[model samples]
Target: MEPIIHGILLAFGLILPLGVQNIFVFTQGVTQSNFIKALPAAITAAICDTLLIVLAILGLSLIVLQFDWLRIILVVAGILFLVYMGKVIWTSPAANNKETVALSMKKQILFALSVSLLNPHALLDTIGVIGTSAVKYSRQDQLLFTYACIVVSWFWFFGLATFGAVLKKVTIPQGVFLLFNKSSAVFIWGTAIYLLIGLWQGAY
Candidate 1:
C-alpha cells in the first residue's frame, strides 16, 4: 500500500512540471475546442511511456544508461526535432479552419510520439526516476508501480484534453491565438535546449 502511494506520488511529481506535453495540450484546448482530438496524442504518449517502463523493468534501459554516446545522440536529435516543430508552430496561421482540423489528428499523434520517444526528458523520467524507484519493490510491486504510471498518463491526458475542449468556446482575439502559438514555440524550443544541456553534462 505504501508502495502504491509512493508510485502515485512519484507519477504526479514527475508530470506536474511544465514540459512540451503540457504546453501542447493546453494549446490544443485553446484552439480545437474539442478535447477529444487531444486524446490520440495523449494515448500515443502514454503507450510510448509504458513501453519504456517495461523496457526498464527488463533491464534494457540499463544498457541505454550505460551508453553516454547514445544519450548524447538522442539529445541532439531531440533538440533538432523540437526546433523544427517550433519553426512550424511559429509560422502557422492562427485562425481555426477546416484545413487545420483535417490535419489535427495526424499532427497530434505525430507530436505525441515525437515528444514521448525522442525527448531525452522522457527518457530520463522513465529510466532515471520510475525505473530506479521500481527496484525497491518486489515484482508485484513493480507491476503496480507501472500501472500507477499509466494511470498518471491517462489522468493527465484526459483531464487536459477535457479542459482544453471546454476553453475552446471562450471568445478570444485573433492576436491571442497567434500569441499562443508563439508561446508554444518558445516552450518547445526551450525544453529542447534544456534536454541538450542535460545531454552535454552527462556526456562530459
Candidate 2:
C-alpha cells in the first residue's frame, strides 16, 4: 500500500516537469483556438507514453540499464533534440498564422507519436524511473504502478492541453505571446543544459 502511494507520488513528480510535450501543448493552445485539434496530439502522446511504460515494466528497460555508455549517448541526443525543438517553437508564427499551421488530425497524431516515441527523455522517464521503481513490488503492485504511470501521462497531457486551450481566451498582445514562446524556449534550453551536465558528471 505504501509502495503504491509512493509510486503515485513519484509518477506525479516525474511527469509534472516542463518538457517537450508540455511546451508543444502550451504553444498550440496559445496560437490556435481549435481545442479539438489539440486532443489528437495529447491522445497520441498518451498512447505512446503508455506503450513505453508497459515496455519498460516488461523488461525492455534492461536494455537501457545494461548499457552505461548508451545513457550518455541518449543524454547528448536528447539535449540536442530539445534544443532544436525549442528553437522551432521560438520561431513559430503567432495567432495570425494559426489557421495556416493548424495541422490536420492525421498529421498532428503522427507528429505527437513521433515526438513522444523518439524522445530520449520519455524513454528515461518510463524505463529509468517507472520501471526501476516498480521492481521492488509484487506483480500486483507492479501493475498498479504501471497503471499509475498511465494515469499520470493521461492527466498531464489532458490538463496541459486544456490549459493551452484556455490561454486562447486571453487578449494579450502578440508581442506578449511571442515573449511567452521565447521564455518557453529558454526553459527547454536550460533543461537541456542540466541534462548534459548530469551526463557529463556521470561519465567521469
Q: TM-scores across all candidates?
A: 0.61, 0.62
Per-residue lDDT for 90 in model 2?
A: 71
Q: Pick the candidate with the highest TM-score.
A: 2
30-128, model 2: which lDDT tens digit per residue?
A: 555677767887888888888988988778335544665654555566567667856775786543323225666788777787789888877876776
Which numbered prediction scores highest in lDDT against the true structure? 2
Error of 1 at 158 (Å): 1.3
Q: Candidate 1 residues 79-131, lDDT tens each?
A: 67667766876787774421124237789889878877898867876666566
Q: How good is model 1 by TM-score?
A: 0.61
TM-score of 2: 0.62
Cα lDDT listed for each candidate:
0.64, 0.65
